[model samples]
Target: MAKGKEVRLTIVLECTTCVRNGGNVNKASTGISRYITQKNRHNTPNRLELRKFCPYCYKHTIHGEIKK
Candidate 1:
């Protein structure tokens, strides 16, 4: 990771129950600054998660990236 390097990110919208909130994940907002960390021993950014409130659900939920 270099200074001022841009990381590839995907913002997914989710509900408190871990279910897909909207029709797709890409329709979510990305205005917030996210902190990403490695999920496994390999030290790669495998897990993409964001904690945010879903207006549809009216609660905080864990939004995970949807792989194509």
Candidate 2:
């Protein structure tokens, strides 16, 4: 069985550009690109965001934390 809570947590980061441009019906989203990383729950309780490369966007964009 797992403990009540965990210190280090695994999270998913999704491209914000992909989400904002989701209305385009012609080009089907390659699906929002995601990056998996770990964070210390006690240190940073807020959602994390990072600039990362989005292949679909063809540029670096803000990737925000999303629920798994």
Highest TM-score among the candidates is held by which one?
2
Candidate 1 whole-model C-alpha lDDT, 0 to 1: 0.44
Residue pairs in candidate 2 whose N, alpha carbon or C atoms collide under 3 angstroms? none
Encode model 2's per-residue lDDT on 1-68: one tens digit a residue: 47648899999998888888783422754667789999999999999999999877778989999999
lDDT of each: 0.44, 0.84
Cα lDDT for residue 9, model 2? 94
Q: Which ranges of candidate 2 are over 4 A from the true structure?
A: 23-29
State the lDDT of candidate 1 residue by residue for 5-55, as single tens digits: 545443343343434333333445423322233233234466456676655
